[model samples]
Target: MSFSKIFGGKKKEQAPSTGEAIQRLRQTEEMLNKKQDFLEKKITEELKTARNKGTKDKRAALNALKRKKRLEKQLQQIDGTLSTIEFQREALENANTNSEVLKTMGYAAKALKNAHQHLDVDDVHDLMDDISESMDVSNEISEAISTQPAFDTVDEDELLAELEELEQEELDEKLLDVGPSVSDRLPDVPSEAPAHREKAKKVDDDDDMAELAAWAS
Candidate 1:
């Protein structure tokens, strides 16, 4: 028999990719949701009919209730199928996402490896150590430049004492060069009052006249 004949004259369908499978599952979920909605509406209608026919027509009410039960069962089955399909779709999506992430991470790892191909750990460590040493040296140089000059060879207290003595000597020399005070330059004056001095002079004159008269007699 020919291959086509052996295969019933139809080719086997190709397997779906992950994306196509997910799409189909979503379509099935939509269909089941529609069916569930329809069954729910039918169940509601049957329940209402049964309630309305209650006690009035026992056969009709029982039939309506039976129909409602059948529709509820169908809705429950659709719900179950929808749950299963949704779980499967979610699991597939998660697997696909994880696969893509893993692939991207693998590429990143390869690129990183290539980037480090020319680098040696020992050489990198040596370079970093050299950089650290250079930074330390630079900091030392900066500190030296910013520091004030030392006065280690000088004596501050002795220098200040000598300066004060020199200042005192200069003041003494200036005082010696200056003339005497105004009181010393003025003429001497009598200790007594002017009226007393005049009275003493008159008394001495009178005594002299008396002596002259005595002498003449």
Candidate 2:
């Protein structure tokens, strides 16, 4: 039997509804926000304890506080991300058609791109949202493309020329950073025999005789 006949004969499982998926996303967002809040509180308490301690322990406590503060900042970013995802889920929920969905997804994509531009924290949730949105848009685009006429001609020579130019430009940049070739930098090796040649030759002959005697024994 063909592979498609075996696998395609079975009915594929239905995916969850958009509302159901959005609810799940919202729950996850809430959970992350709560965790972030807890981390923030813990960091704050540590900072307070450090402030009350004596000078000797104060330095150590302060270092701990700094570490905790860094963690708190990360958690705060997590909270922000959760909020952003929740917003995206809400937007997706309200979207009716593929076009509407695309619009909402575009908003999420733009938000993520802006976050990257501004050096904001990028979490897994943001990445997943971007990917999910892009995949949905891509499927629609692919479907549309499939309905259109296929192109028969491609300018391979033009593409090859562009590729060659790009490669040459990269080689040029690399050559600019490299010094002159080894032949230009170093003197040529001498062809003359060394003054110790006879002594060295005698040492090799003696070692060869010792090896021959050992092999004979």
Candidate 3:
């Protein structure tokens, strides 16, 4: 019932967005195109009427031609207006596309800047060099530890002399053992020869005793 509730309370209409403006322009263009087609048909009909009238109806033909001219002027004005609207719409669309492209490029630049915030070319190079040096040092240390210790090198002539001395000592011991074995075998042979002579003397005594016994018998 109050004035504020009746009028002042109403919300103000929002401005049309670019999209809405473009839509309206397209609609106007379509309407204008339909009107153009209608005008063209009317012009054709008027032409037919003027031609058929010839001199039989001069005033009616003149009036039809005049109407046709007026419709053509109106059609021309609509075409110009449609062209203006289309130009404005296309301009707005190009501006919008450019704006979006610039915004995306700005975001990409910001992300790239953030990514490079903690990186330094010098530091990266130094780090790689340090890693490579450490690996080389580790390899050298491993090789040093794994390598076998070298034994003392002996002279070839000294080794040959020592081997010959060992051979000569073994040969002398074998010769001394051979001397004891051969003497043992020779003593056994002489004892067997004395036993054989004693047995032969005993056999000769038995034969003499048997011959004396036979003579006494």
Estimate the overall C-alpha local distance difference test score of candidate 1.
0.92
For all predicted structures, in order, the TM-scores are 0.63, 0.36, 0.50
> Residues 1-217, candidate 1, lDDT per residue (tens digit)?
7888877776788988788899999999988888888888899999999999999999999999999989888888888888899999999999889988999999999999999999999999999999999999999999999887786567889999999999999999998789997888999987777989899999999999999999999
Best by lDDT: 1
Which rank order by TM-score, best down to worst? 1, 3, 2
The lDDT of model 3 is: 0.88
RMSD of 2: 41.6
Kindly report which residue stretches of model 3 are placed more than 4 angstroms away from their true locations once superposed.
1-13, 113-217
Candidate 2 vs candidate 3: the TM-score winner is 3
lDDT of 3 by residue, 103-181 (tens): 8999999999999999999999999999999999999999999887677556899999999999999999989877556
Reference-based lDDT, each prediction: 0.92, 0.81, 0.88
Candidate 2 off by > 4 Å:
1-14, 96-217
Candidate 1 accuracy as TM-score: 0.63
